[model samples]
Structures are given as structure tokens and as C-alpha cells.
Target: MKTRIKFSKEGNLRFVGHLDMMRYFQKANRRAELPVAYSEGFHPHQIMSFAAPLGMGLEGKAEYFDLRITEEGAATLHSAEAAERLNREMAEGIRILSFLRLPDDSPNCMSIVHAADYEILFRAVAPEDKIAGQFVDGSAYRSLTGDEERSLRAAVDELLQRKEIPVQKTGKKGNLRELDLRPMIHALRCEDNRLRCTVAQGSEANLKPELLLSALFSLDTARPFAAMPRRVVRTELYDSAGKTLESYGTIF
Candidate 1:
């Protein structure tokens, strides 16, 4: 039988990378003595997969993983009990939220994942309040006075309309490639000192939340605020049709 686990990453633990988290989970599973299945052949390994890998230094309230279990007795263990047991043994920043049984025919987490919602917070070095007030107050600032802001808005709008927004591909023999960011960006808006964005996921078209922020910063000459922390929080996960497949509360 297959099981889906939902969890949260927060606090200082946000610095943990995906691969390290995987290894941690494998160790926890072993410690918990969960009857997780092993792969066939000589190099047999845990049958586990993550829905989406969160970037380093970002936090997530909703993260998911799927695992196969072998023993029917183990399958009968209550998911809630397993979650509680895991949390007791887990480190401070990582918490297992919930676990549920999944249909054997359900699609893999990687393939089914399509979108992610994130909240980004940062302090602007420029006179953000003054500039934002002008835009919100409906008093048109002189074109020359707010040229940087105007230019930034124009760039964002143009990028939104484009069929593809090319981003530099890393870790490849060819360092540069055009990635279709249009399909990835479902929504992007700024509010309350934060930029909220929902973007497509998976191999098809992936957008790094940091890249969006970088693009905005690149448009203006003002330096970002010193000693102002930038934080990212992933709020939710969705499927291709924009349906919530699993939530943080229900993720183990």
C-alpha cells in the first residue's frame, strides 16, 4: 500500500536542503521501524518520493512525500499515530503534520504537482512607502520622478504577456537556455510588504521565487535594505488543474 505524508519546514531548519532532508527522513523511518518497502535488486532502497523540493533558506507549511509499505500489519498502523511518533523523534524545525493512505493508482507526487503558492517578505532600500503611496493615491507622479518604478512595472507587465521568459539554466554544459516562464506564472502581486506569487511546478516549467525578486531588484538602481531579512514561505501546493491535492494540515 502507498501512504502520503505531509509536513512543515520552519524556523532555522529552513536552511536544510532537499537531499539532506531526504536522508533525515530515511533515518527517521528506520528509527520508527515503519515497514516501508525497499526497491528490488542489489541496490534496494526506500520507495519514497517528494512532491516538490523547497529551496534552501525558504520555509514551507505544506510539503508532501509518498512512500510504499510492505507489511499489511504496518499498513494498518494509524497514520496519526505514526505522525505523532515521528514528530517526537524529529528535530525542532521539522515537524510531521499528518499522513494518509493513498490509492495505489494515484499519480506520483512529482508528476501530479503543478503549482505552488509563496509569500516573500523584504525591506526596500528605496522610499517604498512614498512610491507606493503615489501609485495607490491615484496622484500621478511626474514621469521623470518615478521613472524607475514606471520602468519596473512595464517590465513586469511585458514579461507577463510574453510566451516565454528566458532564465539562465544552471548546472548544464550549455549555461544559457530559454525557459517558458509564462506557463509557470499563474499569479504575481505585491501587497503588505510582501510579494505573493503562485507558479507552475515540475519539469515542464519551473520558476524560482528568488528569481522573481531578483528581477524586481535588478530593475531599480536603489540597493536593498541593509540588515533587512528576506524570507519566503510556501503556503500551499496544487495540481495541474489548480486543485489542492494535499494541504499542510494533512501532510505527514
Candidate 2:
């Protein structure tokens, strides 16, 4: 049986890296004596996979994972009662929101996840006293200048229509790869010192939330700043059809 678990990370736990979190969950399953199936190999391991790994220093309300169990009864271990038992043993800043059964044919959360929505908070700039103020001012200016706003919108639209938007993927060679960011960008809105956007999913065209924000910032050349203090909170995850993928409300 396959079980999907939704959870949140908060407090100091937001600093924990992906691999460490995986280890933490593995230990939790062991302590609970879950009849989780192990891979058939020399070095067998629990069959578990996260929907998406959270970036360091960012807090979010939604996160999820899918786990395969050897015995059907082990699926019952994800119940609310079992979740509470697991939470009691889990360290502070980590909370299990819910666990539910999924259809055997259901796509893996990681592969089916097509878009992620996030809200980022940053420092205010220009004449605005608050970050929100800057966002409002920028919006007003854009609205007042019809031609400029139209041109900017057109450029973004054209970019979205492309088959691929090449970006540098940092790896052993620091090579350039053609990733279609168009499918990844569902929407982008700015308010005050916060920028909210949704980008497409899948490993092939995944866009870092920060990279999207950087592109938006570069759109305006007149406003110059060395850096910005930004914090991101993932709001939701969606599929290609724009359906909510899973609830990770407790993770943030």
C-alpha cells in the first residue's frame, strides 16, 4: 500500500537540509516499528520519496511525500492516532499534518507536482516606507504607463510561449541547459515587499523561486540595489491541471 504524508517544518527545523530530514523520518519509522518495506538489494532501505525538497532557511505550510509499505496493515500507521504518536517522538519544529491512502495508479507526488506557489518577503526600496508600499507604487506606475506596461507584459508573455528558456544548471561542469520555464511560471504578482509566484514542476524545468524573483527585479533597470533580504514560504503545490497536489499546511 502507498501512503501519502503531509507535514510542515517550522522554527529552527527550517534550517535542516533535505538529506537530514530524510534520515529523521527513517528513524521515526524505525522507532514506530512500522512494517515498511525495504528495497530488495544488498543494502536495503525504506521506500520513501519526498514530493519536493524544501530549500534551506525558507518556511512553508505545505509539503508532502509518498511511502510504500510492505504490509497493508502498515498503512494504518499513518492514521491520526499514529501521527500523534509519531509527533510525540519527533523533535520540535516538525509536525505531521495528515496521512491518507492513495490509489495504486496515482502518480508519484514528485513527478505529478507541476507547479508550486510561494510568497516571498523582502526589504522595501525606493520611496515606499514598507515593502508593501514599494509594491503598490510599482503597480501604480505600471498601470499609469499603458504602453510600457503593455510592452513588459508582452515580453513576459512571449517568454512563456517559448518551448524552452535556457538556464545555467550548476553541476560538475556548470553547464547551460534549455529548461522550459514557461510551463513552470503559472502566475507572478508583487505586493509591497512581497512577491508571490507559481512555477511549473518536474525536475526538467523546475525554477528556483529565487531565480524567478531575480528575473522580475532585473526587469526594472532604474531601481538599483546590491542585495535584498528575502524569506520564502511555499503556499501550495499543484498538478498540471491546476489541482492542489497535497496538503503540507503543518510543515510551515
Candidate 3:
């Protein structure tokens, strides 16, 4: 039997890397005594796989992982009770949101992740600093003209209109590959201090949202962009059709 685990990472746990998180769960499941299946070998490891690895400093709202379980009365272990058992053993920043029993034919979580929604919160930059700074250094932040605000809104539209936005993508072997980032950015929006965006993610094609954001920041030709995002929070994961991956499974 296979089980899908949905959880969230925040606070200090956001600093934990992917490999460490996997090890944490290994020890966690062992302590919980969940019947997680292990591969047959002298150094057998738990049969677990993650949907997508969250970046070190980012927070994940809905993250998923898959694990196989012993079929001995697996039905009884497929519900909130199982999640509760794991939760008791979890540290403060990680919470097990759901324990789903996927359909027998369903693919693993990693292969099915095609898109992700995210919210990027940026630090405040003074309005005068936003204005090329030469003519506006003495101005107050709130006193900016309507034209200045309108330009801020138009910057996002102009970025998406570019024919090609090239970025250097590093390969696993440390090779550099120049790739166009336009098509992978499915959606982008800039509010006062936040950006809500959706971008491609999968083996077929992947574009980190930060790349798209960097391109957007570059649109401000007059002023040097003063701040990077203060925080990035992954809101959800989806399939190619933009359907939430969790929607494809059944509650255990």
C-alpha cells in the first residue's frame, strides 16, 4: 500500500534542507512506529519520495511526499489516526496536514508536479528611491505623483511582453546553459509589496519564480532595484491542467 503525506514547513524548519528533512522523517516514522516499508538490502532505506524540494529559505504551505507501507491491514493505517501518530513525533515547525491513500495506478508525486503557486513578499523601498533618484531624492514616499504609481503597475506588463528573457541555468555537472524564461512564467502579479505568481515546475520544463521576478525587477531602468524579496511562501502545487495535486487523491 502507498500513502501520500501532505505537510507544511515554517519557522526554523524553513532553514532545513531537503536531505535533512528526509532524514528527519525517517527517524520520525520509526519513532511513530508506522508500518513504512523499507527496501530489502543490508543498508535498506525507507521507500519515500518527495514531490518537490522547497528552497532553503522559503516556506511551504502544501508539500507532499510518498511512502510505501506494509499491506498487513494497511486499510486501518490510512486515515487521520496515521497522521496523528506522525504529528505527535514531529517538531514544532512541521505539521502533517493529510494522510491520503492514492489510487493504485496513480503516479508518484514528483513526476506529477507541473506547476506551483507562490507569494513573494518584498521589503519596502521608498518611493523616491523608486524614481530614478536624481530628481526625486528629496521627495516623500507618499507624495509620489499618480504617474509614478502607474509606471510601477506597467512594469509587470512590460516584462511579460518581452520576446525572450534569457537566464543562465546551471546543470548538475556545473555546466551553464542559457535558457529563455518567457513561456514558463504562467502568471505574474505585483501588488504593493507582494508578488503572486505561478510558474512551470517538472522534469519536462522548470522555471524558478525568482528568475521571473529578477526579470521584472530589471524593468525599472531608471532606479536600481533596492530590495529583494523578504520572504517566499509556496501556496500550492498543481498538475498540468492547473488542478491541485491533492484533488487527485482520496482521503484515507
Which candidate comes out best when scored by lDDT?
3
Q: Summarize candidate 1's per-residue lDDT along 100-204 as a digit string, tens digits.
A: 777767887878888899976542335443332221113322222355445444555655666766566564686766555566788876545455789877777
Candidate 2 lDDT tens digits, 110-167: 8877778887655443444322323211321111133433544554455556565555
- Summarize candidate 3's per-residue lDDT along 58-89 as a digit string, tens digits: 88889999988888848567678889999999
Q: Where does candidate 1 stray beyond 4 Å?
A: 123-167, 221-228, 247-252
For each candidate, what TM-score against the reference? Answer: 0.77, 0.73, 0.84
Compared with the true structure, the alpha-carbon lDDT of candidate 2 equals 0.65
For model 3, state the Cα shift of residue 77 in Å.
1.7
RMSD after CA superposition, every candidate: 7.4, 6.7, 6.6
| TM-score between model 3 and native | 0.84
Report how far residue 154 has shifted in candidate 3, in Å. Answer: 2.0
Per-model lDDT: 0.70, 0.65, 0.77
Q: Which stretches of candidate 2 lie over 4 Å from their true place?
A: 75-78, 123-172, 177-183, 221-226, 247-252
